[model samples]
Target: MGWLALDEGYEISLVEGKVAVRRPEGRQLKALPKALRDHPEVDRLRRLAEWLERHEAACAAQVDTWMVSSLPVPTELLARVWPDGAWQAALRDLAVVPDDDPDEVGFLRDATPGGELKVVNLDGETVRLSPRTVTLPHPVLLPDLDDVREFAAELDITQRVEQIHRPTWAKPADLEPAATEVRDYAGGVFPTRFGLAARATGLGYRVSGGYATCKVRDSGRAVEAAVWIGEPYWDDETATGALNWHDEDGRAVRLGEVGPVAWSEGMRMAAALYAGRRIEEGGDEA
Candidate 1:
Protein backbone atom coordinates (compact mmCIF):
# COMPACT_ATOMS: atom_id res chain seq x y z
CA MET A 1 0.00 0.00 0.00
CA GLY A 2 1.28 3.43 -0.96
CA TRP A 3 0.92 6.19 1.63
CA LEU A 4 -0.70 9.51 0.75
CA ALA A 5 -0.34 12.90 2.48
CA LEU A 6 -1.77 13.91 5.87
CA ASP A 7 -5.48 14.63 6.45
CA GLU A 8 -6.86 15.99 9.72
CA GLY A 9 -4.39 14.17 11.97
CA TYR A 10 -4.05 10.97 9.98
CA GLU A 11 -1.91 9.47 7.26
CA ILE A 12 -3.98 7.83 4.50
CA SER A 13 -3.18 4.95 2.13
CA LEU A 14 -4.71 3.07 -0.76
CA VAL A 15 -4.88 -0.51 0.43
CA GLU A 16 -6.40 -3.68 -0.95
CA GLY A 17 -9.60 -2.41 -2.54
CA LYS A 18 -9.97 1.21 -1.44
CA VAL A 19 -8.42 4.31 0.04
CA ALA A 20 -8.64 4.38 3.83
CA VAL A 21 -7.02 5.73 6.96
CA ARG A 22 -3.58 4.34 7.71
CA ARG A 23 -3.94 6.98 10.43
CA PRO A 24 -3.53 9.88 7.82
CA GLU A 25 -3.80 11.05 3.92
CA GLY A 26 -5.62 12.86 0.66
CA ARG A 27 -8.09 12.81 -2.37
CA GLN A 28 -6.58 11.40 -5.58
CA LEU A 29 -8.00 7.83 -5.65
CA LYS A 30 -8.47 7.46 -9.40
CA ALA A 31 -6.96 3.93 -9.47
CA LEU A 32 -9.77 2.48 -7.29
CA PRO A 33 -12.66 1.00 -9.22
CA LYS A 34 -15.88 3.03 -9.27
CA ALA A 35 -17.63 0.22 -7.38
CA LEU A 36 -15.06 0.41 -4.60
CA ARG A 37 -15.62 4.14 -4.17
CA ASP A 38 -18.38 3.23 -1.76
CA HIS A 39 -16.16 0.82 0.14
CA PRO A 40 -16.25 1.22 3.92
CA GLU A 41 -12.66 2.42 3.91
CA VAL A 42 -13.31 5.01 1.21
CA ASP A 43 -16.49 6.18 2.90
CA ARG A 44 -14.73 6.57 6.25
CA LEU A 45 -11.96 8.61 4.65
CA ARG A 46 -14.51 10.81 2.85
CA ARG A 47 -16.47 11.38 6.03
CA LEU A 48 -13.32 12.33 7.91
CA ALA A 49 -12.45 14.93 5.31
CA GLU A 50 -15.91 16.49 5.41
CA TRP A 51 -15.84 16.59 9.20
CA LEU A 52 -12.41 18.21 9.29
CA GLU A 53 -13.57 21.05 7.04
CA ARG A 54 -16.58 21.69 9.28
CA HIS A 55 -14.56 21.43 12.48
CA GLU A 56 -12.02 24.02 11.37
CA ALA A 57 -14.82 26.46 10.53
CA ALA A 58 -16.56 25.83 13.85
CA CYS A 59 -13.37 26.43 15.80
CA ALA A 60 -12.67 29.70 14.03
CA ALA A 61 -16.20 30.95 14.50
CA GLN A 62 -16.13 30.15 18.22
CA VAL A 63 -12.77 31.79 18.65
CA ASP A 64 -14.02 34.93 16.89
CA THR A 65 -16.94 35.19 19.30
CA TRP A 66 -14.73 34.62 22.30
CA MET A 67 -12.41 37.40 21.14
CA VAL A 68 -15.18 39.90 20.52
CA SER A 69 -17.24 39.27 23.62
CA SER A 70 -14.75 37.68 25.98
CA LEU A 71 -17.36 35.11 26.83
CA PRO A 72 -16.25 32.33 29.11
CA VAL A 73 -16.66 28.81 27.74
CA PRO A 74 -17.50 26.04 30.11
CA THR A 75 -14.86 23.31 30.47
CA GLU A 76 -17.65 20.77 30.33
CA LEU A 77 -18.53 22.20 26.96
CA LEU A 78 -14.98 21.74 25.68
CA ALA A 79 -14.92 18.17 26.92
CA ARG A 80 -18.21 17.57 25.17
CA VAL A 81 -16.89 19.02 21.91
CA TRP A 82 -13.60 17.15 22.21
CA PRO A 83 -14.84 13.69 21.24
CA ASP A 84 -15.29 14.96 17.69
CA GLY A 85 -11.87 14.90 16.03
CA ALA A 86 -12.57 18.12 14.17
CA TRP A 87 -13.24 19.98 17.39
CA GLN A 88 -10.30 18.29 19.04
CA ALA A 89 -8.06 19.41 16.21
CA ALA A 90 -9.43 22.94 16.28
CA LEU A 91 -8.97 23.21 20.03
CA ARG A 92 -5.77 21.20 20.58
CA ASP A 93 -3.10 23.83 20.04
CA LEU A 94 -4.40 27.09 21.47
CA ALA A 95 -3.88 28.52 24.95
CA VAL A 96 -6.85 28.61 27.27
CA VAL A 97 -7.56 29.86 30.77
CA PRO A 98 -9.54 27.45 32.83
CA ASP A 99 -12.07 29.33 35.00
CA ASP A 100 -10.77 32.66 33.66
CA ASP A 101 -7.90 32.51 36.08
CA PRO A 102 -5.08 34.94 35.35
CA ASP A 103 -2.44 33.06 37.27
CA GLU A 104 -1.95 30.36 34.67
CA VAL A 105 -2.88 29.38 31.12
CA GLY A 106 -2.42 26.05 29.39
CA PHE A 107 -2.31 24.73 25.85
CA LEU A 108 -4.93 22.05 25.36
CA ARG A 109 -3.36 18.70 24.62
CA ASP A 110 -6.23 16.31 25.01
CA ALA A 111 -9.69 15.88 26.48
CA THR A 112 -10.40 12.69 28.32
CA PRO A 113 -13.65 10.76 27.91
CA GLY A 114 -14.26 10.95 31.66
CA GLY A 115 -14.60 14.74 31.24
CA GLU A 116 -11.02 15.47 32.07
CA LEU A 117 -8.65 17.66 30.03
CA LYS A 118 -4.90 17.44 29.55
CA VAL A 119 -2.99 20.61 28.93
CA VAL A 120 0.63 21.75 28.62
CA ASN A 121 1.45 24.77 30.69
CA LEU A 122 3.87 27.52 29.65
CA ASP A 123 6.58 25.88 31.70
CA GLY A 124 6.14 22.65 29.73
CA GLU A 125 4.23 20.89 32.43
CA THR A 126 1.21 18.65 31.87
CA VAL A 127 -1.86 19.73 33.79
CA ARG A 128 -5.40 18.47 33.86
CA LEU A 129 -8.45 20.63 33.32
CA SER A 130 -9.39 21.84 36.80
CA PRO A 131 -11.78 24.71 36.19
CA ARG A 132 -15.48 24.38 35.57
CA THR A 133 -15.20 26.82 32.63
CA VAL A 134 -12.47 27.90 30.20
CA THR A 135 -11.84 31.03 28.22
CA LEU A 136 -9.61 31.70 25.21
CA PRO A 137 -7.74 34.74 26.45
CA HIS A 138 -6.78 37.61 24.16
CA PRO A 139 -3.00 37.89 23.70
CA VAL A 140 -2.69 41.29 25.33
CA LEU A 141 -4.15 39.85 28.50
CA LEU A 142 -1.06 37.69 28.90
CA PRO A 143 1.85 40.03 29.47
CA ASP A 144 4.21 37.10 29.95
CA LEU A 145 3.53 35.51 26.57
CA ASP A 146 5.68 37.90 24.59
CA ASP A 147 7.39 35.05 22.79
CA VAL A 148 4.13 33.46 21.62
CA ARG A 149 2.83 36.83 20.54
CA GLU A 150 5.98 37.68 18.60
CA PHE A 151 6.06 34.28 16.93
CA ALA A 152 2.44 34.57 15.84
CA ALA A 153 3.12 37.96 14.23
CA GLU A 154 6.27 36.66 12.47
CA LEU A 155 4.10 33.98 10.92
CA ASP A 156 1.65 36.70 9.77
CA ILE A 157 -1.30 34.81 11.15
CA THR A 158 -4.75 36.21 10.49
CA GLN A 159 -6.07 38.15 13.48
CA ARG A 160 -9.16 35.99 13.71
CA VAL A 161 -7.22 32.80 14.38
CA GLU A 162 -4.46 34.62 16.20
CA GLN A 163 -7.01 36.11 18.53
CA ILE A 164 -6.47 33.10 20.69
CA HIS A 165 -3.02 34.61 21.33
CA ARG A 166 -3.55 38.29 20.55
CA PRO A 167 -4.78 41.12 22.70
CA THR A 168 -7.85 43.16 21.79
CA TRP A 169 -8.05 46.92 22.13
CA ALA A 170 -10.67 48.42 24.38
CA LYS A 171 -10.49 51.48 22.18
CA PRO A 172 -10.05 51.63 18.41
CA ALA A 173 -6.46 51.30 17.20
CA ASP A 174 -6.42 54.92 16.03
CA LEU A 175 -5.50 57.48 18.65
CA GLU A 176 -8.25 59.85 19.76
CA PRO A 177 -10.71 58.05 17.50
CA ALA A 178 -13.58 59.96 15.95
CA ALA A 179 -17.01 59.23 14.61
CA THR A 180 -16.67 59.11 10.84
CA GLU A 181 -20.29 58.64 9.86
CA VAL A 182 -23.95 58.78 10.74
CA ARG A 183 -26.04 56.09 9.01
CA ASP A 184 -29.81 55.65 9.19
CA TYR A 185 -32.46 53.09 8.33
CA ALA A 186 -36.17 52.72 8.96
CA GLY A 187 -37.31 50.14 11.54
CA GLY A 188 -39.26 48.16 8.93
CA VAL A 189 -36.01 47.37 7.16
CA PHE A 190 -34.54 45.29 10.01
CA PRO A 191 -36.84 43.08 12.06
CA THR A 192 -34.48 40.76 13.87
CA ARG A 193 -31.73 41.93 16.22
CA PHE A 194 -29.59 38.88 15.57
CA GLY A 195 -29.61 39.47 11.81
CA LEU A 196 -28.37 43.05 12.17
CA ALA A 197 -25.75 42.03 14.68
CA ALA A 198 -24.66 39.24 12.38
CA ARG A 199 -24.29 41.63 9.45
CA ALA A 200 -22.10 44.10 11.35
CA THR A 201 -20.29 41.16 12.88
CA GLY A 202 -19.61 39.76 9.40
CA LEU A 203 -18.09 43.16 8.64
CA GLY A 204 -15.79 42.83 11.71
CA TYR A 205 -17.93 44.60 14.28
CA ARG A 206 -18.23 43.51 17.89
CA VAL A 207 -21.76 42.85 19.15
CA SER A 208 -22.44 43.91 22.71
CA GLY A 209 -24.82 46.05 24.75
CA GLY A 210 -27.40 46.20 21.98
CA TYR A 211 -24.85 47.69 19.62
CA ALA A 212 -23.05 46.30 16.56
CA THR A 213 -19.86 48.29 16.24
CA CYS A 214 -16.57 48.28 14.30
CA LYS A 215 -13.39 50.26 14.07
CA VAL A 216 -12.79 51.23 10.46
CA ARG A 217 -9.92 52.97 8.71
CA ASP A 218 -11.25 56.29 7.48
CA SER A 219 -8.92 58.56 5.51
CA GLY A 220 -5.91 57.08 7.32
CA ARG A 221 -7.60 57.57 10.67
CA ALA A 222 -9.24 54.86 12.76
CA VAL A 223 -12.88 55.71 13.26
CA GLU A 224 -15.60 53.70 14.96
CA ALA A 225 -19.32 53.19 14.60
CA ALA A 226 -21.57 51.82 17.33
CA VAL A 227 -24.76 50.95 15.47
CA TRP A 228 -27.49 50.75 18.03
CA ILE A 229 -29.89 47.86 18.26
CA GLY A 230 -33.39 48.18 19.71
CA GLU A 231 -32.42 46.09 22.72
CA PRO A 232 -29.24 44.81 24.30
CA TYR A 233 -30.51 41.46 25.53
CA TRP A 234 -30.03 38.64 23.04
CA ASP A 235 -33.43 37.13 23.92
CA ASP A 236 -35.41 40.29 23.28
CA GLU A 237 -36.29 39.34 19.70
CA THR A 238 -36.02 42.92 18.53
CA ALA A 239 -34.07 44.47 15.64
CA THR A 240 -32.32 47.78 15.45
CA GLY A 241 -35.21 50.17 14.79
CA ALA A 242 -32.81 53.01 14.01
CA LEU A 243 -29.02 53.33 14.27
CA ASN A 244 -26.57 56.08 15.23
CA TRP A 245 -22.80 56.60 15.57
CA HIS A 246 -20.63 58.19 18.26
CA ASP A 247 -17.06 59.42 18.18
CA GLU A 248 -14.39 58.58 20.74
CA ASP A 249 -15.54 61.62 22.65
CA GLY A 250 -19.05 60.20 22.40
CA ARG A 251 -20.14 63.03 20.18
CA ALA A 252 -22.36 62.68 17.14
CA VAL A 253 -20.99 63.19 13.63
CA ARG A 254 -23.17 64.28 10.74
CA LEU A 255 -23.27 62.22 7.54
CA GLY A 256 -22.15 65.26 5.53
CA GLU A 257 -18.92 65.37 7.54
CA VAL A 258 -18.16 61.61 7.47
CA GLY A 259 -15.40 60.14 5.27
CA PRO A 260 -16.13 58.10 2.15
CA VAL A 261 -14.94 54.69 3.31
CA ALA A 262 -16.61 54.91 6.70
CA TRP A 263 -19.82 56.15 5.14
CA SER A 264 -19.98 53.29 2.66
CA GLU A 265 -19.12 50.71 5.32
CA GLY A 266 -21.73 52.01 7.78
CA MET A 267 -24.36 52.00 5.06
CA ARG A 268 -23.28 48.53 3.95
CA MET A 269 -23.53 47.34 7.53
CA ALA A 270 -27.03 48.75 7.90
CA ALA A 271 -28.23 47.33 4.61
CA ALA A 272 -26.73 43.90 5.18
CA LEU A 273 -28.12 43.70 8.72
CA TYR A 274 -31.50 44.91 7.51
CA ALA A 275 -31.64 42.24 4.81
CA GLY A 276 -30.76 39.37 7.15
CA ARG A 277 -33.69 39.70 9.59
CA ARG A 278 -35.57 36.47 10.21
CA ILE A 279 -39.19 35.96 9.17
CA GLU A 280 -41.69 36.39 11.98
CA GLU A 281 -45.41 35.85 11.36
CA GLY A 282 -45.18 37.40 7.92
CA GLY A 283 -44.98 36.67 4.18
CA ASP A 284 -41.24 37.53 4.09
CA GLU A 285 -38.71 34.71 4.43
CA ALA A 286 -35.13 34.19 3.31
Candidate 2:
Protein backbone atom coordinates (compact mmCIF):
# COMPACT_ATOMS: atom_id res chain seq x y z
CA MET A 1 0.00 0.00 0.00
CA GLY A 2 1.05 3.63 0.67
CA TRP A 3 3.25 4.98 3.44
CA LEU A 4 1.94 8.42 4.39
CA ALA A 5 4.37 10.80 6.06
CA LEU A 6 2.30 12.10 8.91
CA ASP A 7 3.08 15.11 11.08
CA GLU A 8 4.42 12.96 13.94
CA GLY A 9 4.67 9.27 13.08
CA TYR A 10 4.94 7.37 9.82
CA GLU A 11 1.81 5.43 8.95
CA ILE A 12 2.56 2.12 7.31
CA SER A 13 -0.23 0.58 5.28
CA LEU A 14 0.21 -3.21 5.67
CA VAL A 15 -1.18 -6.32 3.98
CA GLU A 16 -4.48 -6.19 5.89
CA GLY A 17 -5.23 -2.88 4.13
CA LYS A 18 -5.01 -0.75 7.31
CA VAL A 19 -2.65 2.04 8.34
CA ALA A 20 -0.66 1.60 11.55
CA VAL A 21 2.25 3.34 13.23
CA ARG A 22 3.82 0.15 14.61
CA ARG A 23 4.93 -3.00 12.77
CA PRO A 24 2.75 -5.99 11.83
CA GLU A 25 3.43 -7.64 15.24
CA GLY A 26 1.65 -4.74 17.00
CA ARG A 27 4.80 -3.65 18.85
CA GLN A 28 4.52 0.12 19.19
CA LEU A 29 7.64 2.25 19.70
CA LYS A 30 7.58 2.96 23.43
CA ALA A 31 11.22 3.91 24.12
CA LEU A 32 11.34 7.12 22.06
CA PRO A 33 12.19 10.33 23.94
CA LYS A 34 9.06 12.15 25.10
CA ALA A 35 10.17 15.45 23.62
CA LEU A 36 11.13 13.98 20.25
CA ARG A 37 8.23 11.55 20.13
CA ASP A 38 5.69 14.15 21.12
CA HIS A 39 7.00 16.84 18.79
CA PRO A 40 4.81 16.77 15.69
CA GLU A 41 7.72 17.12 13.32
CA VAL A 42 9.96 14.55 14.98
CA ASP A 43 7.07 12.14 15.29
CA ARG A 44 6.67 12.31 11.54
CA LEU A 45 10.35 11.49 11.11
CA ARG A 46 10.12 8.43 13.36
CA ARG A 47 7.16 7.11 11.44
CA LEU A 48 8.97 7.64 8.18
CA ALA A 49 12.01 5.78 9.50
CA GLU A 50 9.96 2.79 10.56
CA TRP A 51 8.13 2.79 7.27
CA LEU A 52 11.39 2.93 5.40
CA GLU A 53 12.95 0.12 7.43
CA ARG A 54 10.06 -2.26 6.97
CA HIS A 55 9.78 -1.53 3.26
CA GLU A 56 13.53 -1.82 2.92
CA ALA A 57 13.36 -5.31 4.37
CA ALA A 58 10.43 -6.17 2.15
CA CYS A 59 12.28 -5.06 -0.95
CA ALA A 60 15.44 -6.88 0.18
CA ALA A 61 13.31 -9.99 0.30
CA GLN A 62 12.52 -9.11 -3.34
CA VAL A 63 9.02 -7.74 -2.83
CA ASP A 64 7.69 -5.68 -5.72
CA THR A 65 6.18 -2.23 -6.16
CA TRP A 66 6.47 0.16 -3.21
CA MET A 67 4.67 3.47 -3.60
CA VAL A 68 6.05 6.60 -1.94
CA SER A 69 4.54 10.06 -1.82
CA SER A 70 6.26 13.08 -3.33
CA LEU A 71 8.20 13.63 -0.09
CA PRO A 72 11.84 12.71 -0.46
CA VAL A 73 13.29 10.16 1.92
CA PRO A 74 16.67 10.50 3.57
CA THR A 75 19.51 9.24 1.38
CA GLU A 76 21.00 7.21 4.24
CA LEU A 77 17.93 5.01 4.51
CA LEU A 78 17.76 4.62 0.74
CA ALA A 79 21.38 3.49 0.66
CA ARG A 80 21.02 1.09 3.60
CA VAL A 81 18.20 -0.73 1.84
CA TRP A 82 19.68 -0.52 -1.60
CA PRO A 83 23.29 -1.46 -1.05
CA ASP A 84 23.61 -2.72 -4.61
CA GLY A 85 21.99 0.36 -6.10
CA ALA A 86 19.18 -1.56 -7.77
CA TRP A 87 16.22 -0.28 -5.74
CA GLN A 88 14.83 1.97 -8.44
CA ALA A 89 15.43 -0.66 -11.05
CA ALA A 90 13.86 -3.32 -8.86
CA LEU A 91 10.95 -1.11 -7.97
CA ARG A 92 10.21 -0.38 -11.60
CA ASP A 93 9.77 -4.06 -12.25
CA LEU A 94 7.19 -4.47 -9.49
CA ALA A 95 4.49 -1.92 -10.35
CA VAL A 96 0.81 -2.48 -11.36
CA VAL A 97 0.50 -6.06 -10.11
CA PRO A 98 -2.77 -7.80 -9.40
CA ASP A 99 -4.31 -7.84 -5.91
CA ASP A 100 -3.88 -11.58 -5.62
CA ASP A 101 -0.10 -11.39 -5.91
CA PRO A 102 1.99 -11.36 -2.74
CA ASP A 103 3.90 -8.28 -1.57
CA GLU A 104 7.14 -9.64 -3.02
CA VAL A 105 7.19 -10.36 -6.76
CA GLY A 106 9.55 -11.76 -9.33
CA PHE A 107 10.55 -10.80 -12.84
CA LEU A 108 8.33 -11.67 -15.78
CA ARG A 109 8.99 -11.55 -19.51
CA ASP A 110 7.12 -11.24 -22.81
CA ALA A 111 7.97 -10.99 -26.51
CA THR A 112 8.40 -7.50 -27.93
CA PRO A 113 9.66 -5.80 -31.08
CA GLY A 114 13.17 -6.20 -29.75
CA GLY A 115 12.53 -9.82 -28.84
CA GLU A 116 11.75 -11.24 -25.37
CA LEU A 117 11.97 -8.65 -22.61
CA LYS A 118 11.52 -9.14 -18.87
CA VAL A 119 9.93 -6.71 -16.43
CA VAL A 120 8.99 -6.79 -12.76
CA ASN A 121 5.46 -7.97 -12.11
CA LEU A 122 4.82 -9.40 -15.53
CA ASP A 123 1.29 -10.14 -14.29
CA GLY A 124 0.65 -6.43 -13.74
CA GLU A 125 -1.91 -4.68 -15.85
CA THR A 126 0.31 -1.81 -16.91
CA VAL A 127 3.55 -2.83 -18.56
CA ARG A 128 5.72 0.21 -19.35
CA LEU A 129 8.13 -0.97 -22.03
CA SER A 130 11.14 0.94 -23.20
CA PRO A 131 13.99 0.12 -25.53
CA ARG A 132 16.28 -0.94 -22.72
CA THR A 133 13.99 -1.64 -19.78
CA VAL A 134 10.44 -2.26 -18.58
CA THR A 135 8.63 -0.84 -15.52
CA LEU A 136 5.55 -1.53 -13.43
CA PRO A 137 3.70 0.41 -10.72
CA HIS A 138 5.39 0.05 -7.36
CA PRO A 139 3.00 -1.46 -4.84
CA VAL A 140 4.52 0.12 -1.74
CA LEU A 141 4.55 3.56 -3.31
CA LEU A 142 0.98 3.36 -4.56
CA PRO A 143 -1.56 5.60 -2.78
CA ASP A 144 -3.54 2.64 -1.52
CA LEU A 145 -4.77 -0.72 -2.70
CA ASP A 146 -8.33 0.56 -2.83
CA ASP A 147 -7.32 3.42 -5.03
CA VAL A 148 -5.35 1.07 -7.27
CA ARG A 149 -8.21 -1.40 -7.41
CA GLU A 150 -10.56 1.40 -8.37
CA PHE A 151 -8.12 2.55 -11.01
CA ALA A 152 -7.86 -0.96 -12.41
CA ALA A 153 -11.63 -1.23 -12.54
CA GLU A 154 -11.83 1.95 -14.58
CA LEU A 155 -8.81 1.48 -16.84
CA ASP A 156 -7.81 -1.49 -18.94
CA ILE A 157 -4.67 -3.22 -17.62
CA THR A 158 -3.90 -5.51 -20.55
CA GLN A 159 -2.56 -2.84 -22.85
CA ARG A 160 1.02 -3.42 -24.02
CA VAL A 161 3.15 -0.32 -24.38
CA GLU A 162 5.31 0.30 -27.44
CA GLN A 163 7.60 3.00 -26.10
CA ILE A 164 8.61 5.02 -23.02
CA HIS A 165 10.47 8.33 -23.18
CA ARG A 166 13.26 8.81 -20.66
CA PRO A 167 14.02 12.28 -19.33
CA THR A 168 17.01 14.34 -20.59
CA TRP A 169 18.73 17.68 -20.00
CA ALA A 170 19.57 20.30 -22.66
CA LYS A 171 20.25 24.05 -23.01
CA PRO A 172 17.59 26.47 -24.17
CA ALA A 173 17.71 27.85 -27.70
CA ASP A 174 18.42 31.43 -28.72
CA LEU A 175 14.93 32.41 -30.02
CA GLU A 176 14.22 34.70 -32.95
CA PRO A 177 11.62 37.56 -33.19
CA ALA A 178 9.53 35.61 -35.67
CA ALA A 179 9.28 32.84 -33.10
CA THR A 180 8.66 35.31 -30.27
CA GLU A 181 5.96 37.20 -32.21
CA VAL A 182 4.42 33.91 -33.25
CA ARG A 183 4.35 32.86 -29.59
CA ASP A 184 2.87 36.24 -28.59
CA TYR A 185 0.07 36.24 -31.17
CA ALA A 186 -0.93 32.72 -30.19
CA GLY A 187 -2.18 33.70 -26.70
CA GLY A 188 0.69 31.77 -25.21
CA VAL A 189 1.37 31.15 -21.52
CA PHE A 190 4.42 29.61 -19.90
CA PRO A 191 6.61 29.97 -22.99
CA THR A 192 9.08 27.20 -22.20
CA ARG A 193 12.06 26.30 -24.37
CA PHE A 194 10.15 23.22 -25.40
CA GLY A 195 7.13 25.37 -26.24
CA LEU A 196 9.36 27.61 -28.33
CA ALA A 197 10.66 24.59 -30.23
CA ALA A 198 7.13 23.31 -30.69
CA ARG A 199 5.91 26.67 -31.97
CA ALA A 200 8.81 26.89 -34.40
CA THR A 201 8.02 23.35 -35.53
CA GLY A 202 4.35 24.41 -36.08
CA LEU A 203 2.98 22.35 -33.13
CA GLY A 204 2.56 25.25 -30.63
CA TYR A 205 1.92 29.04 -30.74
CA ARG A 206 4.15 32.13 -30.41
CA VAL A 207 3.89 35.17 -28.15
CA SER A 208 5.43 38.66 -27.93
CA GLY A 209 4.00 41.74 -26.15
CA GLY A 210 0.61 41.57 -24.37
CA TYR A 211 -1.48 41.46 -27.57
CA ALA A 212 -1.45 38.67 -30.15
CA THR A 213 0.81 38.99 -33.24
CA CYS A 214 1.84 35.66 -34.88
CA LYS A 215 -0.82 33.92 -36.91
CA VAL A 216 -1.22 30.18 -37.52
CA ARG A 217 -1.62 29.00 -41.10
CA ASP A 218 -3.65 26.08 -42.46
CA SER A 219 -3.12 24.98 -46.04
CA GLY A 220 -1.14 28.24 -46.60
CA ARG A 221 -3.92 30.39 -45.03
CA ALA A 222 -4.05 32.08 -41.61
CA VAL A 223 -6.12 30.32 -38.96
CA GLU A 224 -5.33 31.69 -35.44
CA ALA A 225 -3.34 34.68 -34.13
CA ALA A 226 -0.64 34.50 -31.41
CA VAL A 227 -0.35 36.42 -28.13
CA TRP A 228 2.36 37.39 -25.65
CA ILE A 229 2.98 34.92 -22.83
CA GLY A 230 3.90 35.44 -19.20
CA GLU A 231 7.35 34.81 -17.73
CA PRO A 232 8.84 31.36 -18.02
CA TYR A 233 10.47 31.00 -14.62
CA TRP A 234 9.19 29.16 -11.55
CA ASP A 235 9.06 32.18 -9.22
CA ASP A 236 8.17 35.90 -9.48
CA GLU A 237 11.21 37.45 -7.76
CA THR A 238 13.53 36.12 -10.49
CA ALA A 239 11.45 37.51 -13.35
CA THR A 240 13.41 40.72 -13.84
CA GLY A 241 15.52 41.55 -16.98
CA ALA A 242 14.61 41.06 -20.60
CA LEU A 243 15.79 37.96 -22.45
CA ASN A 244 17.25 38.42 -25.91
CA TRP A 245 15.64 36.26 -28.63
CA HIS A 246 18.33 35.70 -31.25
CA ASP A 247 18.09 35.35 -35.03
CA GLU A 248 20.12 33.67 -37.78
CA ASP A 249 22.35 36.76 -38.18
CA GLY A 250 23.49 36.28 -34.53
CA ARG A 251 21.70 39.50 -33.51
CA ALA A 252 19.05 39.95 -30.81
CA VAL A 253 15.58 40.64 -32.25
CA ARG A 254 12.96 39.97 -29.48
CA LEU A 255 13.14 41.03 -25.85
CA GLY A 256 11.22 39.61 -22.88
CA GLU A 257 11.56 38.99 -19.15
CA VAL A 258 10.92 36.04 -16.90
CA GLY A 259 7.40 36.37 -15.56
CA PRO A 260 5.29 34.54 -12.97
CA VAL A 261 4.83 30.99 -14.18
CA ALA A 262 4.57 27.58 -12.56
CA TRP A 263 7.01 25.65 -14.76
CA SER A 264 10.56 26.57 -15.72
CA GLU A 265 11.36 27.16 -19.40
CA GLY A 266 14.72 25.53 -18.91
CA MET A 267 13.13 22.33 -17.66
CA ARG A 268 10.65 22.32 -20.55
CA MET A 269 13.44 22.93 -23.01
CA ALA A 270 15.39 20.03 -21.52
CA ALA A 271 12.35 17.77 -21.87
CA ALA A 272 12.02 18.70 -25.54
CA LEU A 273 15.66 17.89 -26.09
CA TYR A 274 15.15 14.59 -24.34
CA ALA A 275 12.41 13.92 -26.89
CA GLY A 276 15.03 14.50 -29.62
CA ARG A 277 13.85 17.88 -30.96
CA ARG A 278 15.99 20.87 -31.94
CA ILE A 279 15.42 24.57 -31.22
CA GLU A 280 16.96 27.08 -33.67
CA GLU A 281 16.98 30.86 -33.94
CA GLY A 282 18.38 33.63 -36.16
CA GLY A 283 20.25 35.86 -33.67
CA ASP A 284 20.24 37.35 -30.17
CA GLU A 285 18.59 40.60 -28.95
CA ALA A 286 18.03 42.64 -25.79
Against the hidden true structure, what lDDT does model 2 obtain?
0.32
Highest TM-score among the candidates is held by which one? 1
Can you tell me which runs of candidate 1 are displaced by over 4 Å? 1-52, 150-161, 164-174, 177-286
- Tens digits of per-residue lDDT, candidate 2, 133-226, equal 2223333233344554444444433322110111212223564324332221121223354344344345222444322122212122222322
Q: What lDDT does each candidate get?
A: 0.59, 0.32
- Model 2, stretches more than 4 Å misplaced? 1-286
lDDT of 1 by residue, 1-286 (tens): 4564443444456453335553322544345555555666567766766765666787776765563344577777877888875566556667777774666677677877676778767666788876777767655455556765654455443343555443232223342344443344435345556666667667566887777776554544455656667575454466555545556676776544555545545565565566666656866554
TM per prediction: 0.46, 0.22
